[model samples]
Each structure stands twice: as structure tokens, then as C-alpha cells.
Target: MTPASLVRRSETWNFDIDAYTNPYTPPSPLHRFPPWLSRFLGYRKEQKEDVGNVLGAVWSCVGTVLGLAVIAAVFNNTASIRAHNPPALIASFGASAVLEYNAIRSPLGQPRNALLGHTISAIVGVAITKLFQLSPHFESVKWVAGAVSCGTASALMLLTGTVHPPGGASAVLAATSPEIMAMGWYFVGLVVWGTTLMLGVGLGVNNVQRRFPLYWWTPVDLRELQRRRRRDGRADVENDVQPEKIVDVVREGEEKVSLGGIRIEAWGVEVPEDLVLSKEEAMLLEVLRERLRKRGDDGVLERVPSSRPSTDCTMVLSRSGRSGSDTEVLYSVT
Candidate 1:
């Protein structure tokens, strides 16, 4: 073929093999330090900080105190209520509810998680203990019954879209407590009261913290499974590339597959084994981490993984939402 024909053919079959080059590499050190402009203006770019968290905690306690006071007023005829003593109720039950709220939302305060989790769990605990008391047929198997009840309660809570960590305590509390046993199924009243009090406090406190109420019912992430179809003509090749076939090829001999898992065994990294941040931003992560652990401060890096990141953040699509946004923080969403 003539040189002109060769040139035309090469142009006709154009390809860019390296299609996924990321313009952004490891983040810059300067980004860790906020530009003077941001500090001066106090621009709130993210919701993560001590501000909302601290205030949310304080208000939850305040709400708990107020709830106990309301109860004391209603039951004024009782001997304990006669002396106008709200101390025991407020200090024990009310205080625990607040701590329980903290337990539900602390570290990562996913809103919808706390409400139903505690409510359902508290009821389960009461049920388990009550079931043990009435187990005439299984008199010697109360312990096993209680455990199975707890496990069943746990599965129910997880299945029903509420997985509050503290609620497990609530369930166990009702199941194991002598006082709870005295109350019997009447402990359902306690469950209702505690749940109502928590919901009220969470709503009020979260509002002051500027958290949207919809967050309580909305999921932070959604999972989607995709199916791909092959071209009509390629039966054999299509079979090889089917979903299960692809999985077999990739996972047949591999037991573990994570960035850190590969790094230690393949690349010989020496840092504490779990920091598997991507190659691009790993340095910045280590720097901020060391600053916090050794120097006792978050320092330059404000926050990391404080919220659930959207998986879309990792892809290099036509218009990345944060393409030109502030560079100080980088998110890991893979």
C-alpha cells in the first residue's frame, strides 16, 4: 500500500488506550492548610465539625431532663413523686437515654438509624425476659431461649431498617433486669416512653444542629446490581464474559482484594497495615493521620470519612460535580 493509504487507515482506526488518566494526582500540601480567605470568612463548606455534634449532645441531655420532669408531674401521687424528687428518674433512666442517643449517632450520626433501632430493640428485650418467665415447657432452657430471642430480635432490627448499637443494650437491659421482670409485659410502657422521649429529643436537637428530618427515613446509600448483554453474533466469547464466568476468573484464586491487601503483599508498604488509601492521596492521609495521633490535633486536615461518600465521586465522568471545588479535602468512595 502507498504511504497515503497507510496514513488514512491509521486515522480511520483511532484509539486512546490510556482512557482513564486522572489529571489530579496526590493532593498538594498547601491544601491541608486552609487558604487565608476561608478562615477569615468562616465559610461552611462541610457539615462535619465539633459545632453541630457538641450542640446536638447538649440538647439531647436537656430534652431528656425535661421529659423526666414532665413524667414526674403526671405521676405526682406516687410515693417517690410525693417528695417532688425527680432526681432518681432523671439521673438514671433519662441520663441513660441521652447516652443511648449518643451511642446511636456518635462517630457517624446516621439519622434514620437511631429511632426505630432503639424502639424495636427495647421491646424485644422485654419480650425475651417475659418469654423466659413463662417457659413452662422449657423450664431448664431459659438461658438458651433468651439468647435465641436476642438473636431473633437483632435480625429483625437489621431487617426492618433500624440497627442502633445502643438498642442492643436496651434489649439486653430489659431482658436481664430484675426490675424489668417485675414490670413484665407492662415493660412495653417503658419501651413506649423511652422511644417517645428519644424521638422528641432527636427531632429537636437535630433541628438545632440543622440536620434535615428526612435524613431519618432516607438511606445514605443505595445498591444497584447491573446486568450486561453481549452482541448477538459472539456466542462462545459471550459465554466466557458472562457474569459468573468473569467472577470465576477474577476471584477463583484470590481470597482477598483490597488496596491495602495488595499493597502489603505486592508493594511492600511499611505503614500500619490498615491504611489502604489510594496511591494518589495516601500521602496526605498519612500526614493528617500522624498529625492527629502524635500531635493530639486534627490540625491541617479537618475531617475524613466523616460522612458516607457517594460512589460516583470516584469515576472520571464528563463533569465531576466537584471538579473545581475546594481541594483541601479529598473523599474515598470506592
Candidate 2:
């Protein structure tokens, strides 16, 4: 059976196959070799680090290297690469690189985020570093200043909902070099050419490997997500809710207090023990319930089927109960 299938099928039973049949231990930090033992009898042992199936890890690492290496080699000594270039041009290639790598390994790193995120951050990092270079105060401490600049860039990336780790490295590399730093506002091109080349390398190497998944993804939309939100309908599918909406809700101060640590208040209702809705879902449902829960609201305790339930037959109180309002409310599935 395939690794994924093996995991899925194994879940139906509870024998702890990982421990009995194929136990794995991560590499230890200590490599012991006593003075007497080191004289002639040296024992070498290999530890397992990549735990989510061996084949997958190797293929992923190989792809990652190819992706990073290609850009590094090309952009490191090129005049065409620089900062402050057009975003669309940068994204066109950068996004492709990331998407191609993810296509061979994971499917989530799509063209949109991958393109905009990496290029932008890399450029921003280079910009921040360049800003510090313009001042005579930071000239003597360029390395430290550049590192700090990258940190700030990383923070900006987090705030912007785009955190690409390699982008930081790319930025620091360009900013510290006198040649790249001199490129001034035009340094964005370096990131584009470098990142795109790396992704190209990853695509070429990964396509030849079998341990990785084929460059095939079952593209999913919101309707598909809603359909799969049921147990029987999407038993094998995994779901990931976008976290940006949650951040927006928090920024807007929607959930005032933690009702049983829920950070939202309501009446005539007990919060589920483990209501793990995404930030967007929580904020939306909270708002919807409050607006519908006016004092004269009827059927305050009505059963409404979930518009987006999980792949299980359990009911989620998608909307909260209001006090004495007039309204009829809305599940298990096959």
C-alpha cells in the first residue's frame, strides 16, 4: 500500500504499527565515541529524521534543493537581477517556481501566494537593508544592520499574510553586497531571475523522481470544500481554513470577551466543549447570531443544520441562539 493509503487504512485499526513493525527515532544530538573505543572499533549508526514516510522526505528535500539552488546560482552574479522592479513581472516567474515545486510535493503552494509573497518579501528585505545603507550611522555595522533589516522584513511578511522563508535569505544576500546594494531601487530584478531559475531546477529534478507525487492536483473550490465538509462525502479529504479572515476579525475587535474562553459572548446557549471553527467562521457566525437574536427573536433555541460541517455526522451550532426573537432555524449526513 502507498504511504498515504497505509496511514488511512491503519487508522481503522489500533495496533501501533509505527512502534512494533517500523519504529523510528530521530537523529540524536550526541555522537558518542569513547577514547578507547575510537582507537579501532568505531560503530556507525543511522538515525531516522524524516518521519512521515522515508520516500516522501527524500523527494521533497531534493526538490527543495533544486528549487533554491537554481535561483542562487543565476542571481548571485547577474546584472539583470535587482530590486524595485515591477511586481507582476517578478511574480510571473517567482510564483511559477514555487508552484512547480509544490506541485511535485505539496499542492497548497499555488501560483498566487507563491508568486506575490516571495518576490515582495525579498524586494522589501533588500529595500530595508538598502535604506539602512544610505545612512552613515549604519555603515560600520552593515552585517548587523542587514540582519536586523531582514528581521523587520520578516515581521512585515507575517503582517501581510505572506511568510516565505527563502525570501528573507534572498533579501539579506542582495542587501549586504556592495554591488547589489548599489543597484538601489532596481534590485527587485535579482529576486525574480534568481527565484525563477531555482524553481525551474526543482521542476526538472522532481519530475524524474518517483518518491514524490506526480505534478497533479485535484483543484478544489469553495463549493467542493462545502461538499467535502461532510463525513461520508469527504472522508479521505483534508481541510484547511484560511486564517487571514480570522486575523481581520481580531483586528476589528469582534470577539470582545472570552465566553468560556471563546472570546465571544452570547445568551441561552452553552458553547461546545471544543468549537474549533476558523477565525472567519467564528466571527461570521457570531455576527450572524447576534443580529438574529434581537429581544423578540423567536425560536431562540432552534436547530440549524451546519452550512459547512466536517466529514463527520455531528451537528455544529453554526449560528448561536438569540433571546426571544422570531425566527425558524435550520444535520447529520450519509
Candidate 3:
């Protein structure tokens, strides 16, 4: 005679066991830490700030201000421009300006994308608005028309290799704004002109320190460059100013050359009698040992203490007997 509880337990339905107990299930972060604490901490892996960071931000601000000012001046001073076009100072220009000046290296920030994307999106938006004019009975058709126009413009941007995200806003503006929609081709001219102004400003500002619009139309292939470097045996990895790897290898009996905080301890090789290495392991060990010997022989290896103050400095050795005792050679990373 089975009890009611036992019978009910046995009768319980079994769902997909694999789904609940999946071996490939990714670990959840919820269990690791409290969401509130994590949120408070924010990003853990932030990049270290450099000298150019503040200057770059200032430069970006200046470019945006100048670009917007030019557009505003054009629209405010010229009545004919305002009659046919939406206000030159639109919301999209802010996003465009950021990419143009700050993230000038991105493909979307290129002059071709900025100009073509806005122009095409404007045309698409106007076309969609005109299509909606035919079906005036549908009260909510305008919203749908705007969304569709933006979507189509995005697709067109991708197809044409001019995917400027801000251009979608331009499309939305064209479809939603009655004033701009009424003007037809004149609206496109406004977008082009505004974008052109920003592009010119971006070129001038970015070129001051960094190369903007690395190419006129073609997107720079960073991956291709990396691949070429790899193929070339790391020959041209460094440009005009190559980064120095301050290795501090400790020799058996040598004067320590200190260079600020940068350090790399000497790698010692010791094969124990009980130790066993495979063919590959033995070969690697041999190569490593040879490298160690070569580096040791060079006498360039020295320990740099972590407590040392600055990153850049000059060490002058006043040789008493040497004729050119005061001859100072500068070794700057930049």
C-alpha cells in the first residue's frame, strides 16, 4: 500500500534534464558579487591616462564648437538657407562631431561616410515622407514611415560602405520634420553642407596631432597591417618612436644600471638530475639558454628598482680620464 505523498512524488513530471544541467552552461556573474557593489565599482579594466588624453578632449570640444558655430552662422545669416532647410544645428551633428574629432581613426568618421551617408539618408527620408503623403487616411503612418526610412537608410549605408550611425538620425529628421520634408532636395543640401563643415573642421583639428581620414574613401585595414608585420618577421613593428622594453637582467658580477621603475629579472636555467623533458621541451630550453647567454654577454642587462621615481631620465657617467666627459647623448622614447 503506497502512501499518497510517495505516489505524488513518483508521479511528478520530468522535463528536459539536459537543459537544466547543461555542461556547457556559462558561469553566471550574479553569484560572484552583489549587483549594487559591482555597479558602484564600475569598470575595473580602464586604460591608463596619457599626456594627450586631456588635450584630445579639449581638441574634440573645440572641433564640435567650431563646426556647430559655422553651421549656425550659415543658417542664421542666410534667410534663403533657412526657408528650404531644417536648422543646420541638429542633434545628429553632436554625434558626428564626436566621431570626427575624438574618434577620427574610425572608418565611419571618414569624410566619404560623413558626406555620402547623410546625403543618402536625407534622400531616403524625404522619399518615405512623400510616399506617406499618398495615404493620408492612416493617422499613424508618419511614425512608421520615419522608422522605415531610417532602417532603409542604414541598410543603404552598409551596402554603399558608408555606415555613419548619425546618418540614421538625419533620416529620422527628414521623415518626422514637416518643415524639412516640404523643402525636398534643399534639405539634402543642408545636411551635406553641415557635414562638410564638420568634415573640414575634423581634418584641420585632427591633423594637428593625429592623422584623420587616413584615406579619402577606403577604410584602413589594421588587421591587414598586423598580418603584414607578422609575415615580415616583426621588422617594422615600431614607427618613428619605438617603445622601449626596459629589461633588467642581473649578471653574475656586473654593475647595475638603474632606469627608473622598469625591470626584467635575469632568467636562470637549472636542469635537475631527476627532471625529464620531451624533444620539444628540450629544444625550447636550449634556445632559451642560448638567448640568456647572448643577453648576459651584451652587458646591457641591469636591474631597475621599482621604487625609482620617474620613467624618463638621463644617467651621466663623468669618466675622469675620458676627453668627452661632458658629451651627453639623449635617449628619449618619444
- For this target, which candidate reaches the highest lDDT against the unseen true structure? 3
lDDT of 2 at 34: 69
Please give the lDDT score for candidate 3. Answer: 0.62
Model 2, 118-178: lDDT tens digits are 6776677676776776778766877875687678767766555445555565567555766
Per-candidate alpha-carbon RMSD to the true structure: 26.3, 22.8, 22.6
Query: In candidate 2, residue 224 scores what lDDT?
Result: 42
Task: Give one digit per residue, the lDDT tens place, for model 1 in 59-107.
Answer: 6566566655655454454563344332233222454455434443442
How do the predictions measure up, each by TM-score? 0.39, 0.38, 0.50
Taking all chains together, the TM-score of candidate 1 against the true structure is 0.39
The lDDT values for all models are 0.44, 0.45, 0.62
Which has the higher TM-score value, candidate number 1 or candidate number 3? 3
Question: lDDT by residue for model 3 over 57-169, one digit each (tens)?
Answer: 88888888888888788877788886665555777888888888788767888887889888899889888888887896534778888899999999888877778999999
Lowest summed-lDDT stretch of 10 residues in model 3? Answer: 239-248
The C-alpha stretches of model 1 lying farther than 4 A from their native spots are 1-64, 67-112, 136-145, 209-214, 220-334
| lDDT value for model 2 | 0.45
The clash number for model 1 is 0
